[model samples]
Target: MTNHTVRPRSAGALAAVLAATALVTLGAAAPASASGPACPTDTIIDGSRLASISPECSFAGDQVNVGGVVMSIPNPGASVRASSAVAAGYQDVPDVVVYRAGNGGVAAVAGDQEFGSEGTLAALRSENSAVAASARPSAVSTLDSAPVVPGCDDRTAYKLSGEKWAGAYEWSYNNTGSPVTSGVARIQDALDTVTGGVTRCGSDVDLTATHRYLGTSTNSVDVTKAGGCSEGDDRSTIGWGELSSKYLATTCSWSQDGIIVSSDIKFNNRAPWWDNTGRACQGKTYDLQGTATHEAGHVFGLDHVAPATHQVMKPASDPCEYSQEKLGAGDAEGLKRLYG
Candidate 1:
């Protein structure tokens, strides 16, 4: 199995990183269960000395399965959003294998983790197939109450893939431990900017669906800053952390019966960001507020449309671009279908 786990950092730094997310993850380094992996002891016979056994085993270490399974992110986009439907059978759910990350993030697996025997690797492949959605504010010091990203600027045509928040859900922010270019305030403003009307793209329209900001929290995030999602926490958190070199940001979501219940957002700590406020990107930096605005659209259940369509939910944001800070008519219309 490929060890894609993020390398560990200093104890203090790792704690700070772990404190920022709450997307259904297990505490690191939990002691092994007395009987071992939660499989039925009688499965094929405990007489084989494999100890206890059961379906859906929750390993003490690394909550994500570390078998040879490698899930790849889609192309042309830096971030990936992993989602699954809750079901009785694990096979019924699709688990997104997290790519390996770097230091200052979660533990990255580097080799095969032996549990019982190599023969059992296939069975363990399905274990820990979940993502964390936890969070807390880290280094963002200011909260820009004013709208940072403008709305109604895009003129591109787009269509909706159709998923959304039911009624009104709430979300929180977690900082990067060390302040990034943007502060918590500006991030909030960017998020709020997504819900209203799109007023300038030749087709002015109103999107009435709404969500409340719950302020900042220390909840561990679903996707660690190191580039993977912890499974099963039901909170929607936003925070900063190290991601794979390819990603600028990532979001993890889970739902049941076709309704979204949990979602978390993690901005890549390694990426250059502009708050669209005091600090600006050097040669080419991502507009923090704009990226945030787009991620919020995903938290609200918007799927990515191609960038050519010009919707805020497109997979990629332009470098130093601010257009994504607001919703396009297509973006709003999609939300309208979900919550309207």
Candidate 2:
């Protein structure tokens, strides 16, 4: 058996704003208290080749290996044909699995193998055949299509009122224009400029929202780590001060009578590695305000900023100087696509 890597372009992949390592764990749309839904196992396809596979740390802290290998079964959405094309009615079946590319590899075993309908077998194979095993596999299901991303669908807009922004943070965040408090205001101001001072999307569309908050002193679960922002070498040479472990990233969705939007998260502290002049670790510090502005875009469902720069949504920050705090033309276009 041979392992083939699959790499299909996600509708949301282009809009993903966080680093490749960052996992934007928004508050589930079901409710803040809602328990995570079990990974569905309905569309298990048997007799497929191991096309692509990735490892993901589940919410339960268990490591789940998801694969995008080939399947003998037809893709759920498309007309059965030799040519690969996603079907008309088929939304991708989330959490599907392909087997390891080796002898004695099992066929369609439950839990071990999850399934996604990649239009056609050939298309799925073509898109993913070269995916590397080392890359962290993202969720196969429509996690990207979730109604609640940071910048999608005017989700973050509703949270931008002076009151809403002020309320989400601690008392210390109230200073007039101090670097920290002022950073918070600048982020809000940028959002206000982009959204035209509107807090809600009047029509049915992708919504976005963003806000700032103080972080915990320390926690095993931190956004900076989960989003893989602090661990990479890019941050070290970029001259960010330090990475704070307490920073949090969360997205929440709400839908009862057809209301949907989500918020983004950003941190405002330094990483311990920032002080180490010897370049001990691959770390970076950032302008809390600027990073927040970018992460906010993501929570609202925006991807990374194209033509990357010091702009809010760019994956890596430039050296110590935080210049591009304002949203750029690309940022505005993304916001409009999601909302306006």
Candidate 3:
């Protein structure tokens, strides 16, 4: 499988706040126990030895099975979030894709990865025999819409399918070698804040974390540490999340499969703008919970709101500001529209 890497937008003021560092590449393959059933030979990529094994197999090198389909990545050690949507009978034919974005908030490539050979209409009919014959045409024509936060520029949104997650989603932190002291707790709190805010929309969709450990690798959200002080200097953005791209048409919701937060930036829970006189006008630490909350919003469906402070989805976060930790009116409205 061929891999493509796109650079995210530049980090502006964040550069002044934290020192820069080289990007850490993550490419370890998932163990053999993680492999699923073997797939047909035709489904494998050309010129790759992966055709001999199960589609779920993660090769010794940079190749790994994402949602039962093999994918190649630039950095084998980078965390991956893989998801798939398959029709019946063609259990071997998986409509899946893997996506990755730099630290900057730029969007992920939509049509970059290839799935498989384009089969004839008769082949589709035969493959989906279990599906209602009458519904076959619609199924064939239906294309999953790209999973993207609604308000950001089209360029920065991750090109994934809008696959809504069911029930309360779980999240865990991989803080090994992380610089932040309370990284796990702080990020969990931020996720909770965002989930609670969206719940106010009266939607059934929610997020919860019962454990901090990385358990069975399925659809759970994994919050990992990134090596960057500013958004684009060290990495591409302050943080970015990956979602499944094959299930977009079923629902307009995209399951936030993974997130990476930069450790180079300074963050604190203290309120912003407090003076030396103990008055509220002179503090400078960015709110960690607030930043997490913003990133969580992206995991959901909200995008960056312009003018900086109109809502939690603002494109750029101001240092020492906590207004985004809570959902704004616009944020609530977006959730209601998507989930309600």
> Model 3, range 169-258, lDDT digits (tens) per residue?
444343333344555556566556666543221232332312122332222122211111111111211222222221110101122222
Query: How close to the true structure is residue 288 of candidate 1, measured as C-alpha lDDT?
Result: 77
Which candidate, 1 or 2, has the higher TM-score? 1
> In candidate 1, what are the lDDT values of residues 169-249, reduced to their tens digit?
677778745346456766677666766643234433445557677887987776743344555367887787776555666
Rank the models by TM-score, top first: 1, 3, 2
Superposed by TM-score, candidate 2 places the C-alpha of residue 40 at a distance from the truth, in angstroms, of 12
**Per-residue CA lDDT of candidate 2, range 1-340, in tens?**
1232222122232233222314322211111112221221212222332222111101111111223322222112111000010111222222122222222122232223433323333333432332222122222121124224333222222111000121122211222212232444554544444344122122222233333444322222111222221111111011112222333222111111111222223242333212213333233443443444444454343443322222344444433323334454344444444343
Look at candidate 2 and tell me the lDDT of residue 144: 26
Point out the higher-scoring one by lDDT: 1 or 3: 1
Q: What TM-score do all the candidates reach, one by one?
A: 0.55, 0.33, 0.37
Candidate 2: lDDT over CA atoms? 0.27
Evaluation by TM-score, superior candidate among 2 and 3:
3
Question: Listing every candidate in turn, what is its Cα RMSD in Å to the true structure after a full C-alpha superposition?
Answer: 15.4, 19.7, 18.0
The 0-to-1 C-alpha lDDT of every candidate, in the order given, reads: 0.47, 0.27, 0.32
Ranked candidates (lDDT, high to low): 1, 3, 2
